[model samples]
Target chain A: MDVGIKIIDSRGAACPGPITDLARAYRNSKVGDIFEMWATDKGVKADTQAWATKTGNEILETREDPDKIVIRIKINKR
Target chain B: MKKVLIIGGGGGGLILANHLDTNEFDVTIVDKSDLHFYQPWFLYIAFKGSKRKISRPIGELVRPGVNFVKDEITEINLDERKAYGSRKVVYNYDYIAIATGTSPDPDSIPGLRQIYDEYGDYHSNVYNSQKLWSHVKNFKGGTIAIGQASPTCKCPPSLLEGAFLLEERLRGMGMSVGTSDPLSPSNENDPTKTGEKGKSRIVFFTPFPRAYSAEPMNKVVEPMVKERGIEVMPFFDVDTIDVQNKTINSLEGDSLKYDLPIIVPPCKGPKIKFTPETVQDEERFIKADKNFMKIPGYDDAFAIGDCNTLPTSKTGVTAHLEAMTVSELIQGKYSEFNGRINCPFDTAYGKATFVIADYNNPVVPYPPTATKHFMKMSMARIYWMTLMGTADPIFERFFNITKPEKLNRKYSVPE
Candidate 1:
């Protein structure tokens, strides 16, 4: 069974801090799991896209509302 | 065994020396000064009073087998493959790397040095801190003008950083010097209102049309400057400095007065002789193929860092990336010379922005993209760690991308 992890909303953090935290959390989780990150920093959208491209991770979805960014990632069990 | 001699101990010289393999080529580094400074942190040190803990003894940065020489290089006899230094030592090398960085030439402007010496309190940065600190404390709201004498200046953001932080500090002290008239009447009369001495009103001026000529940065810096309420007078070249009058004469028949003036002087490469064949440009900057970093005609001699006249900004990050490319070319790893190199820059908000350069075509091109700020920050850590004699695993892997033989092919000296 795959595990689902969530990063409870990072609203006002600076660049790379939120992304770094999310990356660190994802690294500790088991392969083939799902990670969801909520952020308010608009740069996170580009950051997540770049992270996925560099790391070869799968991005399930990225949703943007007025105040926050919701992103979901599926880790490939390699 | 190949002998590589590197001149200058700044960011470029040190990193290239650190990156070379110990088993293959013997490296010798010659530098005039013993101290290795983390210059990027100098601005932070001046404003925030934060000391950078990143420096190390110059000796520690060199690889174990590499020879370190402390002397100023007097001349380079490129024809004979020998270099002479002030210590009366003649060193011969199979290859030479020039990384000597630029220095401020205050002497170029008449009366500028005298003014600087007399009004030392106005400009406070890494070079002159004690005077700068005292001046800042005693500043009592007058027109503060920051200007650059020439182009090709390093850390253009330093002036902006100082202005912004000074404004914030002054405001915190209840001295509200707005952007319009930094030395408002209220600021001059009330010494206590200015933090320590009631210094108010600051104005920033640059000779360039834009804050930074480089793109992406140019896009962001102007907004930040205006946001900080710093007045920028573009294209105002200085003709002379009238120290007695506390005024500056501009080439365009304009005169600007200042209570305090911080001037960034013009920068130039050190006086060194290169064989006419070696340097194609009149300026004597080493002429190298943009793609391979190889000196035209001379296979053994290569130039890196500020010493060479590369088209890109003369920053440490650019030097590091170029060194990697040059190393790969020297190692004969042509296959890996995929005509692309990553140039990373630090943004206004302290984020690491980068562009990819493709050098194969006639027109060198760069794409607009930025990496995670962590990656940029981590690279800085990697540089510090490597300089401190600890090879991080991540950087080591990154360095291994291009084989050594590919690097050697592009830089072979003629027999």
Candidate 2:
């Protein structure tokens, strides 16, 4: 079955908020599920990357806008 | 003279208002509370039961020329450069600086608000700190859960500081305490193994996988924590508190039993309203340029301290530096802030370390020493001098030694 991308909007949340939101969503998500997170906290950039790297997830892309940051990740592990 | 309206008479607002050239600008400060608090003292108030010298009247702190208005700022119309206060007063300003820092949101977590309401916490205010002291002062031995409920909080090191100090206080009270490594996983209730039956066990929790978010700082702190027998529960972001059961739950599917819970409540920006709503972010923190501290599209408008989205830790030191930088910027003396962080870490037993860093350099913990501890303690007493700019010469000299360039060179750490 094809899985749809889950959007986790964590804008205005600070460090760990975005990461935690992603982790929470990832835990309930099925394998092969894709996730996109939006955050305003600058720490989200490094945190999302580190969290993905540690959790064995693949970063599909990371887009940075003037006001917010968006990260796309594919779950590779439980 | 140009009228400058400063909302919130906090460390950043007071410092900026005091340092600004009174000859060139007419400054007025508006705050809900008439008192200025030395917030760093909250830790002492919690752990040490200190009740003196932590606050001063905001009126006394403001310089001779600065007008102090005791009213809550309800709205800020940046386009019109007007601010509305709770007293139904509207003030116009040529330039406006918002230093209204973040406020602790007790209700952010489930059951957490009631927990603090009943038992109190040091993070909230003087009353809460005192109430926390009363709750924990007579504690002999039990499970003391000290950690953060929020992902972001002011003074990141305060969690560890409280743990170390509380552990020390327990030991000083002649109680045997042993640490349980939550990183080890198995949640077997072996009180005999962890020494929880007849002794005090401090379980320090953090959302990060490591004891501290910063790796190098973690390296320095983890050892001290382990040495002091403080149990660490990493990756445990507080999800909720079961007050009846006396249990703390984490978002990561872990729960721990506790006798006394002293979790740092979540924080959010002030309740002040902005007309366009774009002035603040989702969490309501004012968005401003990292270098200039100026709100976008408005050259004369700025936000500093916990109120501004500076991408740094919410700390008084960050606020102080930004205040100084913005004060100078208003005078046409532009200096870019290097995201300097100078947080004093008290590791208990009269030893402390200064976690000094900036955007350019990583935090290299200075070897814990009594001198640093003393300096940290002394600053609490002389903090008023800093707000008044009376200690500028000495403070600037001290800051000079801890500058990012100096720290980078001294520690020889890569950027």
Candidate 3:
């Protein structure tokens, strides 16, 4: 089965919204499933990294553009 | 004269109503309740057993010219520029400001409301704060767990500050503050591992990875937290509180036993209905420009304070600054809110620190000092006058002094 990466769009959402979206996505995801998230809040970078570190998730990539922040996470554990 | 209608009579609404040019606009404020409460006082009430004056009649705080009406707004007719109230009164306005702020929703977390009701908490109304005070005063020394049920709550640093203050208070009562590993399997049966009984432990469970969300502020606070022996359990986004078991289980599959658990409740936007649906998001937070506080698709409508989806913390300081920005936008003045935040963080022992930040800057925290503590203590007394813009000049000076953006110039200059 070819499963595309799930995309979670949280653009323009404030602090904690991005993290909450990531968590909600994590709940339905299996180990090794990768998800991409987009957020506009500047604090999303720090928040995402912190949340990933504490939750035992892996950040595959983080790219920041002028308009939005894009982050990819691979589920490491439930 | 243009009619200006302000909703919710909160920090932002009251300031906007009072600051508008009364000569050019007929101002009115609509709120469900007549009481204007200084919510920061809830901390003092819970920890210090303070009976300090914190509430005043809304009418007493509203300026002489601004009409203060007691009415709960239910719906807005955008096309007609009319707001329908629960009292069946219709309000007409040339411009409207929605400042109906967020409320603590304990029901958001499973079993949270039950625990909150049973042990008392400081996150809701005055009665709940008083209940927490009773519990704090009568605490016989056990595991006191402070955690946040929601990731976003008003005064983001308040729970951490409460922990520091609580630890100090318990220690002052001759209760030995102990340390325990919350994740240890045997710890639940014996939460406190101190040498003697009646020893207390402060375990702070947070959704954020650090003690403070902002790294710079966390750098300053984490050390203080360790110095005070406050155990911080990071990534503990609360999932449920087992009321019968006296355990709080996190979404991360961990649980901690507590004799007393104080959870900061989740904040939700006002329940009022808005026209054109675009006025508010699915979360019910009003949609507005972060800098101008102006609602999209409407030139004359504005949303400020906790109701708006601003990127800053949900705090009165943010509301006050947004009020100033919206007030300027209404009066044909050119101004932009730089996302200034100047919140006081109480570090116990009669000392406090200021969390100062802006859009382009991370939080810059000063060392905790008695001077800042006194300033925070005096804020409640002067808050009403501030609504009337009586302290505008003083606030301007304070903001300038604490502006993190100006730190380079401040330190670079010769003494």
Best first by lDDT, ranked: 3, 2, 1
Model 1 residue B359 CA deviation (Å) reads 7.5
Q: What is the lDDT of every predicted structure here?
A: 0.58, 0.80, 0.80
- Point out the worst 10-residue segment of candidate 1 chain B by lDDT: B359-368
Top-lDDT structure, candidate number: 3
On residues B156-201, what C-alpha lDDT tens digit does candidate 2 reach at each position? 8787888888877877776667644342334343565543544677
In order, the B-chain TM-scores come to 0.77, 0.94, 0.94
Distance from true location, Cα of B121 in model 3, Å: 2.1
Residue B210's lDDT within candidate 2 is 66
Clashing pairs in 3: none
Docking quality category of candidate 1 according to DockQ thresholds: incorrect
Candidate 1 structure quality by residue, lDDT tens digits, A1-78: 335565535444321124534543443566677878877544567666755664567899899877678888877732
- Per-residue lDDT tens digits for candidate 1, residues B1-415, read 8888988877777777776776888888899877677665554454455555646667877768877888998788777899899867898998888777776567777767775565442222354644455565566766666666544355444445566666665556666554443345443344333223444555665554445432233454466556645666654556689988888875434577777776766556667766554473433456655555666777777777656655444556556656665555555565122233343444334444343322221111122224444565565556666553355465546445422233223332223
What TM-score does candidate 1 get on C-alpha atoms? 0.66
The best-first sequence of candidates by DockQ reads 3, 2, 1
Q: How well docked is model 2, in DockQ terms?
A: 0.14
TM-score of each: 0.66, 0.86, 0.89
In Å, residue B224's CA in model 3 sits off its true spot by: 1.3
